[model samples]
Target: MVPTTITLHNTGNPLSPAANERGWLTNPANPRQASFHIVVDEREAIECIPLSENAWHAGDGSGSKSGNRTSIGVEICESGNYAKTLDNAVKLVAGMLKDRGWGVDRLRRHWDWSKKICPRLMYDDGKWTGWIDFKNRVNAELKGADNVKLDSEKVNVIVNGKKIKDGKLENGVTYVPLRAVGDALGATIGFDNKTKTATLDMKV
Candidate 1:
């Protein structure tokens, strides 16, 4: 799918984190059909589906010109740390736009697709002020990418009361090993030889 725009959304549920949203998307027993390419939270961005695939996130019905078909879906988790989550989302989304040679004009809110007031948190008293602020942040991020230098430090990655592996801290974000994460959760890991994609599935 050739994405013309990056569609942004809010998970709506204020308590669910990025990992939980990813897990819900990957779980087979989930009856709801909603899906997204990525989920961003305070800590990191978790990919639920490949970017090349179309996610049924935009409320618009499936069609050639529909947002679900023309845009890549990104849901920002609205948990406790909204400020941090927005920062992480800014990095992730700005990086995506930069990598694709796109500008802030390519960013679209879920409301742009359908009438649903998704990303409701961003609506400032029924005004687009919050959306404008978010876009401004993304624009600043895009401009600052070239001038910023990232520093790294080693840190402990603790999962379920166990230190699985030493992780790295960069730009105020911590990076952990995916294998260790899967192992800690007792998830079955598989690698697709053709696509070179590593998948972690739970034993159900």
Candidate 2:
């Protein structure tokens, strides 16, 4: 799976970071057949499963065809300082979104996929607003829209060993049309005006 969405989860166990890491590594197929892409704590974010493969984390069931197969699952550890743990999760999620060119709208709570109240800290304490706030923070970290300026400057763009002249720099950030970049890189690019979204198709 290319991970079109990000799913948030909670470990629900008050285990040390190392203990949580060990659990995932040692039990690849637990009773629930549960697994996740990454486990995050106040100190670090540990990747247990490969992002290229889907993990059975969404709890939507084998035949449901849900987030377990389509989204990247990140379990936040609740055994430490909750604030620090959440900050780590935010950074990890922001990095994932930046790498994939995805927007905050792609974020999904585990609850969104299934009936499970996951990332429990954000759901149980009347703190659902925290999830929204997290998305907003991730969007701001992307720096694509909120940090750009109207003024344009000339910038050289090279794609597939060829120079492209349409690139521009605004507020010290380089900008290029998705279609132009995709074409130069031999990929199909599409835009959805209604959603203001760009889709890129690359041959793997």
Candidate 3:
């Protein structure tokens, strides 16, 4: 099924009775924890492990297909009661969504598809249950174009931070010209002397 929500859990122990410290156990043969594609250690500099197969972290009889099969399930091995882990979890999830071209709408908690109350922290309240807000946050960072505005004046040639040589801005400001700026930005600028045309390009 196409997932429409992303869930974050604090895998750390909690003092509250509602928040159980012990999590699910996996099979030794195919071990569930190893299936998680990326695991971030808040104590370190974002250590990550990429897995080709699914991790059985969800729950027993939960069927790997529902969550791990198509989900980039992440387990944060830090103190969940603190906000640092939660923030890091957000970053990790955002990066995954950007890499896979899946929006925040694709993020999901283990409990959403099964019997376990995975992503334990998120289950405390319904504040973060929805997808729209989370997706918006991810889209803003991934695209990096939402709030950024191109300076169309002052001979503006940069589009997405890359200087377009000799290319005129939409406002008709071809101030620095393409060849000069392109050459400065390490891009190749060409001049068609015969046709009186100039071309500046950079490989994406």
Candidate 4:
């Protein structure tokens, strides 16, 4: 499926954890045939269906224009630690959007597809306040991603057997603050604003 949007849903079963939700989908006797791409909770996110293929989510039927064909489905599990679940869901969804180069505007609720308050928690008793907050949180995550903070998540750097600071590993590439690393290596790093040029000087 060439997904154009993301469709959000809440499991609503506070008693059933993410693992349970995943198990339900996998169970042979569960009878219900609907599927979601990912199910996320506080501690884990599980992928039930591949994003390259469509799932029977959205309840909009198998038509070409239906969300089932045009969008990816993510079900947020609301078991224990509701806030944490929401937080994890935001990260998962934001990562997805970033992977697709999509903005927050591509997010849609189950209500948008089939007029069902499917992500029932976010419906906020029909006021949609919770939904707005949820999208805002996802938007914030996307903004942080744009700022490239994802680089800070891994690795330490060392040069000439000396440890370096501000070392980052993002998308399999290591990045360091040029000025800081240059100074550590007995060099000066300079930048010219007018020309947008960066210069490095080494004293041997």
**Model 2: runs farther than 4 Å from truth?**
28-30, 63-65, 124-127, 144-204
- Model 1, residue 183: distance off in Å is 41
Candidate 3 colliding pairs: 5-107, 5-108, 6-107, 6-108, 32-56, 35-55, 165-178, 166-177, 166-178
Candidate closest to the true structure, highest lDDT: 1
TM-score of 1: 0.70
Instruction: Candidate 1: count the clashes.
Output: 0
Tens digit of per-residue lDDT, candidate 1, span 57-149: 898999999999999999999997787798789889999999999999999999999978877877745655457657766887899942333
* Candidate 3 Cα deviation (angstroms), residue 56: 0.5
Question: How many clashing residue pairs appear in each of the predictions shown?
Answer: 0, 0, 9, 0
Candidate 4 lDDT trough over 10 residues, lowest sum: 145-154
lDDT values for all models: 0.83, 0.75, 0.48, 0.82
* Model 1 alpha-carbon drift over 4 Å, by segment: 145-204
TM-score of each: 0.70, 0.64, 0.47, 0.70
For model 4, name the residue pairs that clash: none
What is the C-alpha lDDT profile of model 3 across 1-204, one tens digit per residue?
343334444454443111122222333453444334445444332323244544444453455355645454566654433344444555667776776677756766666667466565444244332222334445567776333247643444565576553333445535453434654666655544346555666757
Candidate order, lDDT descending? 1, 4, 2, 3
Please, what are the lDDT tens digits per residue for candidate 4 over residues 1-204? 999999999987889888899899879998997988999999999898888999998998999999999999999987897867887898999999999899989999999999999789877457664676677668878887335563356568777788766466777788665655675788755555346565667877
Over 4 Å off in model 4, which ranges? 145-204
